[model samples]
Target: MKPHQQGTERVITSLDWLAVLPVGLLLRQVDLTGCGPTCITVSRWRPGAGAGGLEGTGLCVCKEDGAVCGSDGRSYRSVCALHLRSWVSLQSGGERIRKAHDGECKLAPVIVVSPKKIHNVTGAQVYLSCEVKAVPTPVITWRKVSESPKGVKLLEELPGDRVNMAVQVRGGPSKHEGTGWVLINPLMKEDEGVYQCHATNMAGEAHADGSITVTEQNKSKKASLLAWDNPS
Candidate 1:
């Protein structure tokens, strides 16, 4: 097809040739034939229409378009790319594809903000928090890391009738994100250990760890006194 310059856009006059160019190259061609400024349109050729007739033509090119998500949970470089794929699929007798949303598709959980190490004295309250981002929203759970008698590591889900500890989770300090927190009131020596933030979704799972260190009230004061005396 021969494309002639029409102001800032390109217009294809001949429909005798079909080209399936790479997405990068097509995008770089600023003068790609298009129907409008925002989107690329594609049309199927009519069998009986002469090359001079623009009958049954529908598709255009959008060089500046952003990526789009497909209904099949995949990402396309642009709307034109998705339409091209859909056309190819239809020609192959496969399912027709449609646009799901703007932007790339996400399918896995990611730990955005991990909990940090904490040190506290006995009888003090402490909070550990974690944030995760994922598509379809992820479920956040808190777990305490423990060692078994056989030296294997174990993860115990938190807030199971533990009077001193509580866990809470909620969605979004941002889109597609969830935050979780574990509160330990009147912290004790037994509550000192590694805590895990576990996030799971239909696509996948993610994990992060935080720790708590507790000191008896008397021991904490004594240590402070020792540090003061040493001046180090």
Candidate 2:
């Protein structure tokens, strides 16, 4: 500090820089009523490297090797970047990133499955399933395409008179494996359409299309006999 003729000048030495300033070390400039130049005050502060430099307030300097999993189901280069992005998201009034994990994220659900397209006769049985694996068990639902050319709707549980509900692997409580519904005896016309299996958890939702085609037994027999007789 240099004492001039008017007031005292405060100077922050480079070696005195600290990462954080203590509350007691904090100084404020306030005008004292009827106070002369002798009461003048000078406040100065300098942040160190650990404090993210002078303008590093609310900012982070991430390490190159740092990695973190964001609640938005994305892997970030560093925790600092993740927090910075989260703050940006909040400022924009969008969905906030709620959680973060170390060593990258491996919690989102994954669907390892295939679609089934079947052609069967009337009064035949069929099964539709969807396979999903995740840290948290997923919920499975079935939907059938409307015959009236409309969109699909949620397939509610049956009356349980014919065991029409879905079945799980070894009857486990979780519907993780290829668990799905059972059609006891589907009609040729009433049951021929597209069915869907949807699996959902905290991560996301996945869908698989199942196309069922039921044909009349008599129609195939008559066509086969006519083709055999004409040898065409």
Name the top TM-score candidate. Answer: 1
Q: Please report, as a residue range, the 10-residue window in candidate 1 with the lowest summed lDDT.
A: 22-31
Provide the overall lDDT of each model, using Cα atoms, as 2-decimal numbers: 0.77, 0.52
Residue-level lDDT of model 1, residues 1-232, one tens digit each, is 5556543334444322213333432222223453544454544344456685344334455655577888877777777667656666777899999989888787699999999999999999999999999987999999999999999999999988899999999999998899999999989999999999999998899999999999999998998999999995
User: Which runs of model 1 end up more than 4 angstroms from their true locations?
Assistant: 1-68, 71-104, 229-232
Regions more than 4 Å wrong, model 2? 1-108, 147-178
Q: List model 2 lDDT by residue over 18-51, tens digit each.
A: 1122222222222223222222232332434355
Q: Global lDDT for candidate 1?
A: 0.77
Best by lDDT: 1
- Cα displacement (Å) at residue 18, model 2: 40
